[model samples]
Target: MKFPAPLVRLWHRLGSPRWFFETTAPWLPWLLGLGVALLGAGAFWGLALAPADYLQGNSFRIIYVHVPSAILAQSCYMLMGSCGVVLLVWRMKLADMVLEAAAPIGASFTALALATGAVWGKPTWGTWWAWDARVTSMLILLFLYLGIMGLRQALQRPEAAGRACAILAIVGLVNIPIIKYSVDWWLTLHQPSTFKLTEKPAMPPSMWIPLLLSVLGFYALFIWSVLQSTRVVVLERERRTQWVQNFVAAEGSKA
Candidate 1:
């Protein structure tokens, strides 16, 4: 079967590691700048400018951090799962690098979500931790991330490790929906999401706008971190190649 021209072009473009590196290199600075700017703006606006929650008061400021971290954690897992699929089906090396690069970032965000959730819980729930369905599921998600990272590290051959990690990542996708819907699916201390696509937001625009910005900023940060890490992976993986040798030599001469 013949694929469409555009689809074939896109497939080849994305599958090429050198092309991916060259194309993304120029955008990294811009991505970092945008991420930092939006995050700084959102932090100031949400933590100081936005009105306090009627009941939660200043403690509610934690949402700015907690919500974004949790959202990114889940989204990152989805990205990893998609990359795993591409690696397994298309045998794309770039997909493997992406999957590996995303693991630690996803894990970090998951850890942040748990930490901030615990901190937020202290004042709201009068406890540091609880086995609420959402919380427990999120913890499981973190473990899944760690498991993938461990699996990758354990294998000596790159191809074997990539395949193993890809399978693990694809399988772990089952937990994402559980984490997302756990609040609705079970009796839990965690409240429902503040932002919903189908209805008006739970909070006023003044509050939700900054939150929206925070989410965007966090997403940008995730992309930037992944790109930076992927570049390192590319360099290491391609170190024996002529292009990498020339690139290293150029950098050395500049230094």
Candidate 2:
């Protein structure tokens, strides 16, 4: 049997957690800096400087924060599931760290998404909560995150926990599309995306500039945070190893 070269290479790399850590750690600080700068700029420009919506007025500004967070929330889970699938198929330890690193961050994003959505809903829809398809689906997504985190912690064996979380993540992926297309698929109260902002963003540079930057900023932040947390997860999982102890001791001596 011939093994695909790329897949074989990926599987080999995935087998080593230390390699993944060393490869990704150097990028985290740079990504963090870029994320903060772009996100701050986008939030300020979109929320304060951009002209109010003609229909909804000033209240619509919340979308600048809400929409981005919500979008990231759904996308992050998909990324997690994709990582899980890769881990299970390739038998990669790094894949498990990726999943653990993402769980809390994804859950936090989901919470932020739901919170911001409710706040936006109150002003636009005249209600804070709704039984609408979109809202329900988002709520379910939040639970799915909680479940994955919970399942991971509940299991004793590292491999068993990782496998269980992977399965749960894959099964819960059914809700991603439901959240994405809820507005289109149902007669829900949630509004669809529009093409305008700031006296109607007349050009792509005007509107999409921030949109793209904000999305990238969010993704960068997600990756940076995941890398930082994955370091912790790796340390915890490998605490008995000599490397982690020596690394911690070296840091302490420096301090």
Candidate 3:
């Protein structure tokens, strides 16, 4: 099927590593600065200004970090899975680079979620860890990330490695839904979602507002990290190309 002219043009441009690198060059600093500012502002508002929960009190404040990390972790995986589809079906090289760039970021966020969950759990659940469905599924998501990274390292061929990693990312997508609905699907100690699209948040405006800022910050940072990483990957992979050599020479001359 033929796509609209603009969309097709955009797709072709997006697929070009050189185009992507130059296009995103000016975006990196802006994204990083915005992310840092939003995060810092949100952290202060949540920790110092937002009213403490009557029940969990100060402990509930951890949601500022935990919730955003958990949300971003899943979102990152879903992105990787989409990239996997693009790589496998269209053989888009940038999609593979994005998938590889996202893996470690997703893994790090997943680990942060697990760590903060444990910290939140210790006081609330009286345990550091549990076999709760949501928790276990999240752990599996982290493993899937590690597995992709390991698979990439194990393969000597870049094409082979990208293909293998793409397949794994696509397959591991099953765990995302499982993580999302695990609390409702089975008996577990984990609480239901704090925010839902169909319902008002369980939190008041004071709480949810700061949380929202933090979530936005996390997303901004995710984009910044992916773009920056992809840029480096583009340079490394295209080092033999004229553009990359020119870029390097320009930088060297500036220095």
User: What would the per-residue lDDT of candidate 3 be over residues 46-153, giving only the tens digit for each residue?
Assistant: 999999877677988898999999999989999999999999999999999898788899999999999999888877667788766667778878888899999999
Native RMSD of candidate 1 (Å): 3.6
**Model 2 C-alpha lDDT versus the unseen true structure:** 0.78
TM-score of 1: 0.91
Q: RMSD (Cα, Å) of candidate 2?
A: 4.0
Relative to the unseen true structure, what is the Cα RMSD of model 3?
3.5
- In TM-score terms, candidate 2 sits at 0.85
lDDT of each: 0.87, 0.78, 0.87
| Ordered list by TM-score, greatest first | 1, 3, 2
Estimate the TM-score of every prediction. 0.91, 0.85, 0.90
The candidate 2 region of ten consecutive residues with least summed lDDT is 191-200
Error of 1 at 117 (Å): 0.4
Runs of candidate 2 with Cα error greater than 4 angstroms are 1-11, 178-207
lDDT of 2 by residue, 1-255 (tens): 989999989668767776676677778889999999888887777766676666788787676677778888888898889878977887677778889889989899989989988887787777787655667677888988999999998998989999888888887786567555764476334443432222444534544566666777888888788889987888888888887789789989999
